[model samples]
Target: MQLMEVCVIAKCTYKSETIMFSVSSESSMVDILKTLCLRFRGLQLGCFTLRYSVPSYPSCFLETDSDLDLMRTFLLISNEKTVDILVKDLCGISEYSGDFCVNKELIACEKGESSCSSTVEDRNEFLGRSKRASAKPLLSNEWETYIHHVGQKFDGGAEEFRLKLCKYALEVGFNFLYAGNDKKRVVAVCSNKKLEGCSWRVYASRCEATGSFVIRTLNNVHTCAGRIRESKSKMMRSRVVSSLIVDRIRAKPELKPVEIIHEFKDYYGIDISYYHAWFGKELAKLDVHGDESKSFNELVWYTDAVKETNTGSLCTLDCEAGINRFRRFFVSFGGCIAGFQYCIPLLFIDATFLKSKYKGQLLCASGKNGNQGFYPLAFGVVDSETEENWTWFLQHLASILLPMGRVVTFFSDRNQGLLNAMGFVFPGWPHSYCYYHLKQNLISKYPKSGYGKLLQDRVINLFSRCAYAVTEEEFKVAMEELVIVGSSKVKAFISDLSRDHYANAFFKGMRYGEMANSLAESFNNWVGVFRDLPVLPLIEGIRQKLMVLNSQRRFEAEKWTTVLCPEMETRLCENAEAGRTWAVRRSNSTVFEVFADYSVMVDLEQRTCSCRLWQIDGFPCTHAVAAILAKRDSVYDYVECYYKTDFFRKAYESPIFPIPDIGKGLGSNGSAAVVCFRQLQRGQPEDHQQRGSKFLFVVVKVDGILNVGVDIGQAFNTRRF
Candidate 1:
């Protein structure tokens, strides 16, 4: 007689799944369970052992082939209506195998309820039951939600995470199972959602490493299911979300929270809130720029490092008197000192507002080198552009400069504090207001008057012309035009303005024909991006930029072929070409008269022109050029040293050494180190920067081993080396 065959339904309450498989009365229980596990592609029956638990029948473990048939007889012949079958993992979580269709929709289901349609919305959760195993979509979220409810759902407020994880596996189409106790089952799902088109099965497992448990995806769990498709579980992991947020932040720091929420739905197939992305970005800033307060505290060491690395570099970090936080500070490395030697004597000092927790102004003292590019001499951060702060800035400049015996002209706006400070600090030096700044003040003070734009334009243009006028005659001509326009108030203001400081005719020899502080303004723009950084980072960033500026310029100069710098050569060529129509008649071997529309005297011997261009700019004017060419003299010979390629090269010869962090988390104001730039003169008060050997950093051992670094050279030491 053939062995009797009977169908048993194994219902999985978690996935809302049930399977029907025929079993023979003679078949061993082991074979029955093995066959059942093999049929369900998405189920990991290995984690569970089959058992027959019924009221009449003592809970019997069908551990052997004989036990299967013995239980089949009881189901058939006994008066029991059904046999309560249970699949349980010895360790709660049975092993998972894709070789069987465990997590997938009933591929062989000639039986019960099936999974949701493959045609769910991109935003929909795609893993639950809808209709019978024959067809149709999974049930609504109400019924599907129970898939997340493991163990006893209606039991108090507690729910099992194993079933919850089972729901996640169903959602993502992963081949895994929760194989622990229902009360405290460990949920193990496929960690790598990227598993697709592969023969191997992988599950997420938490294992101990270095005394800490880290989640890892282990492969080698084989699955007969064709190829697991790529899908993300609706279950969102904290780490996974954070990591993706970090990537998006680095790619687009301006990415908003709403975009992140949509990103989870679109790219990740998961849902996240807007606030999550916002808070995540806040955390990301720390990862990218570091903690702001910690960086501020590190400025002391940062300053020390600049002095140490750049040798003759000078830096001063002064905090508020009582609060002992950054108030006003200045730094000018050795390269700045060396560069200034070949630069024009004019210094443009100005201040721009800083955007930080503490409102302040960034004061920059900049000059123009032979290349006519901004030569940042020093930078200071001040609470405001007060007289004391400006004085402090100029005083630091004076300490190194006065000892050199060279009085440098200063070009600045008529900032009351800066003007007052300049008069006191460099009393002998000529201080001029930036005419452009004056023009701005004029425009701001006198808004659109009854004078239409035309008149407004005329007044502004006339004032601008006054700044560039090479002679009092030229300035007076513009001034008369302004007065002709009938703005008596403007005329009076112009008349009161000292031509020496604002007019090219007056500041001719003193300021190199420069009447504006555009150089300082440009310098402010040069390090504008770095100003937003914390104190230590801002200083380090500025220091790094200077190094790049020095290197790039040096490299550029090496490529120049002209005796004069590129810009200077261009100027001379233009001027010489314009002087082509000049009528030059030799007065003597060294003198000539150039009547280029106007008669002017050019004395080559004195390196001067009656127009004063040659003397004031230190470069031959068109008149001087015409005279020099008339006598068969080289025009290059008439140019100033300040315009020479070699002089420009000298300005960048000293290196702006790289500054680095000596230690981590060096907080602000807690430590102190004295820094000097251009060391001070001996027998003098030692708190100033002086002209000395370009770079010398000396460190004295403090505790026989550790070094206390200081910048000291004969130039700044009270006791000479």
Candidate 2:
């Protein structure tokens, strides 16, 4: 009488998973599916559950009642697509006889729960299986204990709270491990790794414990102070590494000298090597942070250069302290000055250390060319007169003049390493020690010794002789007295001094004195005209200084012809008569060639010279102007070319580019523009049918005609009419 009920329990196993369920007589198939879905939250029973879960049922299906509807819905949901399942019955059956039983225990009877527990236990079951999950013990075994302690310390769950703490430590290279009981757990771990420029020298496995919740307690320990301490530890290690780099660089005897690559700026980001201009203000005094600070911007660098130039070729470096931080800024633009190509060769070099400005260490060089006057060439600052320092200076100088050629000679006070480095840099050219340096050293050795006087006189005579000594014996005899001096240091010095190849090479008619560093001191004279001033004023002052030098050289290169007068005209006529284009003047006439090709006239009777080149170039007696008047040539034709622009240009050319921002990627919530458009469209839902700007974009013609388009999904698509 129970409507001929039939209970079909399918006993089947799928991959060791048993499929079994008891079907009720009164309940519909839909009800059974719904019950099954509810019983196993983790399982997926298709739309069979959805059919019974919803309200309305089809009239054709209602005639069969509960079980039939349940079966129909099951068939529809399991056999049809998910979308089609919704169409089968938007609402579920309204009436059901009795409840359907579809518990998980009903399935998987073959494999006992014991077997499941022994093999692969579910997450919740595993959590429950930890015999001591709730038990309070004396010590915790894992990081979970600390996590639990932290949570308990803060009165929160150990699971959700521990992840954050663990993540933070891991980010900085510390892994958390557990070690205490549940009653009073500990959050502890050990670190032995170096991450983010840090040293893990304090390597020790340790532990910490807490009770209940402890987020705040842990967070307080992980403050910025903690980060900074960690960061500083890393930096200390890094400094050691940096020092190692400097040492390794110094050790390589075969390595080339260090070059002054480019002039750095303080404020402005752009770095210009050739033509440079900068404007900066006093953001802060030199040691705003403290004496340990040495930070500086591009502007500060320019300002320093200006000030140092005014201070006579010497200025101390300044910057921020702690960790040796330099200024930070963006590189906007960079380009060479128009006339840089014409100015460089006259580079003056000097080296100084942190000690007294005058005494720490110093090296200087001067250069001269066919058309230029005395010019400063190279200089360096170093801790001492050590081989490394000398090599550093020479290498840097060589790099600055690499394209110029090694034929260029250098003059300096004879320091051992300086001499060695010079030979390494320009092996083919002469690296001469200054005569004054030699003379002074000798005097130091033999203060009142008649031999010292005699030696000095002999040296002066040979140099003034205007020619190389006829024999090497002449130099020996000249040094005969100093040679007799008792001091071995003096003897050795003189011996090295007389070697003719090392220190004495310049003394043997090598034109070494002509390359003396005296003019660099003179150039400093021109710069010291303005040194102490604020940033803007200093820059302005420098501009004037550059202009002065530029104007003077420009004038010299173009004005020497005017200095020659009537006698030159007469000689030209005579030469014209002789069918010659140019005439050579005689030396016997009271004429001297002054610097810059300008001749100075000297009247024999008056003994007065008429040109200023003699004063500027430090060359007198030979007046080109006087010679021109007396039908004789002048010596000015051989004046050095330091005044030429070409020498200045080569000294400056460095590039600067901006550092890129490497932060988070932009706009994660869809394209910014698209999101805005969607928001706008939602605001005008009443006009949803309208296209164009209302939805995406609209183009309007100059005549006011509108072109509308919908993007659909393609971003660049357009429709116009």
**What C-alpha lDDT does candidate 2 achieve relative to the native structure?**
0.34
**Candidate 1 lDDT score relative to the true structure:** 0.61
TM-score of 2: 0.32
Per-residue alpha-carbon lDDT of candidate 2 for residues 294-386, written as tens digits (9 for 90 to 100):
112223344344333332222232222532212111110111122222332333333322211111233444444324343333333232455
Q: Write candidate 1's Cα lDDT for 1-721 as tens digits.
A: 9644574433322232344455645455556555666765554333344556444343466555666666766766664444545443222121222232222223222122345334334113122221112232222112223221112222211132333343334343555533333332243434342454333322222222322122133333333343232334434443335545776655554566688777766654556655556665666545555655455446657777777787776788775464333456788888888778787777888888664333357788887888798888888866566678899998988876776677788888887778789889888588888877788777765647575656667778888887778788898898788778737768677676777777777672467767678888788778777665555556677778888998999999999999999988999999989999878998888989999888999988898899887777778888888888999988988887888999999989998986554446364343322222222222333232223323433222222222323434334222222
Q: Rate residue 602 of model 1 by lDDT.
A: 91
**In model 2, where do residues sit more than 4 Å from their true spots?**
1-292, 295-365, 369-374, 377-384, 448-473, 481-490, 501-516, 521-552, 555-721
The most accurate candidate by lDDT is 1
